[model samples]
Target: MLAKRIIPCLDVKDGRVVKGKQFIHLRDAGDPVELAMFYNEEGADELVFLDISASSEGRNTMVNVVRSVASQLNIPFTVGGGIHSLENIKALLRAGADKVSLNSSAVKTPELITAGSDFFGRQCIVCAIDAKFDKDSGFYRVYIHGGQKRTEWDAIEWAKKAVSLGAGEILLTSMDRDGEKNGFELNLTRKISESVDVPVIASGGAGKLSDFSDVFIRGEADAALAASVFHYKETSVKQVKAYLKQEGVAIR
Candidate 1:
């Protein structure tokens, strides 16, 4: 089996790294460049930098921030938010992002996924799906524009479609679980992971070390991503990996 990955996410708003609950009530975390370097030294398998407000603000991702953070990282990182065109992807790649994640843009124009993967290999493209479980509908609904806009797309259906369109990986976030620290939405994550052939990185609601183990073993996620727990020093990457290793989940 491939080793499962542990990734730290840096959500940036106005160039400062921030964290929030359910995508609102933002609070300052730290400097992006400093946090990136810290995660690099902390043995994170990869890092994710997302400009939380870029899309809503109608602007491109902060390229200078990407460059500064990417320069400090030894491990691969993915950058997202406000990335709407092939040129934007190219610019970020030049700025040193190993992969570019598309959320609102991909939902708006799926062709961008195929076109991006065609121009810059499938491995360079990651489709980020922010989903919230609807109690009345009995299906996870996709959200975009940094979780402000709701779409009719079913999370599982969209994951399959994204892979068919050449997305190499899926970054699936549970909007309901964001910063909850309860645990991952196992059923939601597992359904999508099982439905798609591409790797799935489960994001949100990572509180205890056991949560990571559960997501990998039960959710079957190839990677597990968290923000507040890691950012607030509630747990460290080494601690999580150690617990996962104890639980028989292969780790690098």
Candidate 2:
């Protein structure tokens, strides 16, 4: 069995790391480069840097920030937000990102996924889906443009479509649970994980250490990504890994 990965996320805005509750009322956390280096040394399995406002602001990702954070990390780094074209993905790859996450652009122009995978290989492309429960549809609906807009696509259907279009992995985030310390959306995570063949990274709603184990085991997530808990120092990567190992969860 592959070891479950514990990833630390850097939700950056204006070059600084930030966190918020349910993707609102944003607040500063720290510097992106500093946090990257800290997590690299702190035994994090991987690092994810998201330019949280780039798409909504109608701009490209902050390549400068990507370069700065990339310089400090030896582990795999994934960068996303405001990436619209192949050139944008190329620029980020040259700037040092191992993988480029496609969200808004993927929803707007899905062929980009097949194009990126064809040119750069599927492993270099990740499909990030931000979703929340829809009362009218009675299903999770995909959100885009930094969770500011909703699409008609159902979350489960989109995950399968993204994988079929050549996405190497799925980065699934629960907008309803984002930045909340309660727990991850197990039902959503499990549905996506079971629906996609690619590895699924369960994101959002991670509070206590037990939440990690719960998602990995019950949700069947291949990886778990968290920001607030690690950013606030409520728990460290090493501490979480240790706790997971003790809980009989295979972790790296």
Candidate 3:
């Protein structure tokens, strides 16, 4: 089995790293460059930097910020938010991002996913899905614009479609679980992971070490991403990996 990955997420708003609950009540985390360096030193398998407001603000991602953070990292990192075009993806790659994640843009024009994968390879394309459980509909609904807008797309269907369109990975974030620290949205993660052939990185609501193991073993996620717990020093990548190793989950 391939070793599972432990990733730290840095959600940036206005060029500063921040964290929030359910995508609200935002609080500053730290400098993006500093935090990236710390995670690199902590043995994180990879890092994710997302511009939380870029989509809603109608702008592109922070290239300078990406460059600064990427320069400090030894491990691979994924950058997302406000990435709409092939040029944008090229610019970010030029700025040092190993992968570019598309959310609203991919939904708006799925051809971008196909085009990007064709031009940059599917490995460079990551489809990010921000989903929330709808109690009435009994399904997970996809959200975009940094979780500010709702879409009719069902999360599972979207994941399969994206993968078919050449998205090599899925960065699945559960808005309902964001910052809840209860655990990951295992049902949602597992459903999507099982439905798609591409790797799925489970995001949101990582509170304890076991949450990582649960997502890997039960959810069958390729990777697990956390924000507040790692940002505030509640846990470390080493600690999570140690626990997962103890649980018999393969880890790098």
Worst 10 residues of 3 by lDDT: 20-29
Runs in model 3 deviating more than 4 A are: 19-29, 53-61
In order, candidate lDDTs are 0.87, 0.88, 0.87
Cα lDDT tens digits, model 3, 100-180, are 999999999999999999998999999999999998998999998889899999999999999999999999999999979
lDDT of 2: 0.88
lDDT of 3: 0.87
* TM of each candidate vs. truth: 0.91, 0.90, 0.90
Cα displacement (Å) at residue 25, model 1 = 25
lDDT tens per residue, model 1, 1-252: 679999998888777777533322233235777777767777899999888664534244478788887777778999988888998898888898999999999999999999999998999999999999888899999999889999999999999999999999999999999879999989988998899888999998999989999999899999999888987778989899888888899998
Which residue runs of candidate 1 sit more than 4 Å off their true CA positions?
19-29, 54-61
Clashing pairs in 2: none
Q: Model 2: residues >4 Å from true position, as ranges?
A: 19-30, 53-61
Clashing pairs in 3: none
lDDT of 1 at 153: 96
lDDT tens digits by residue: candidate 2, 28-100: 2356776777678889998888886645442443787778778877899999887889998988888988999
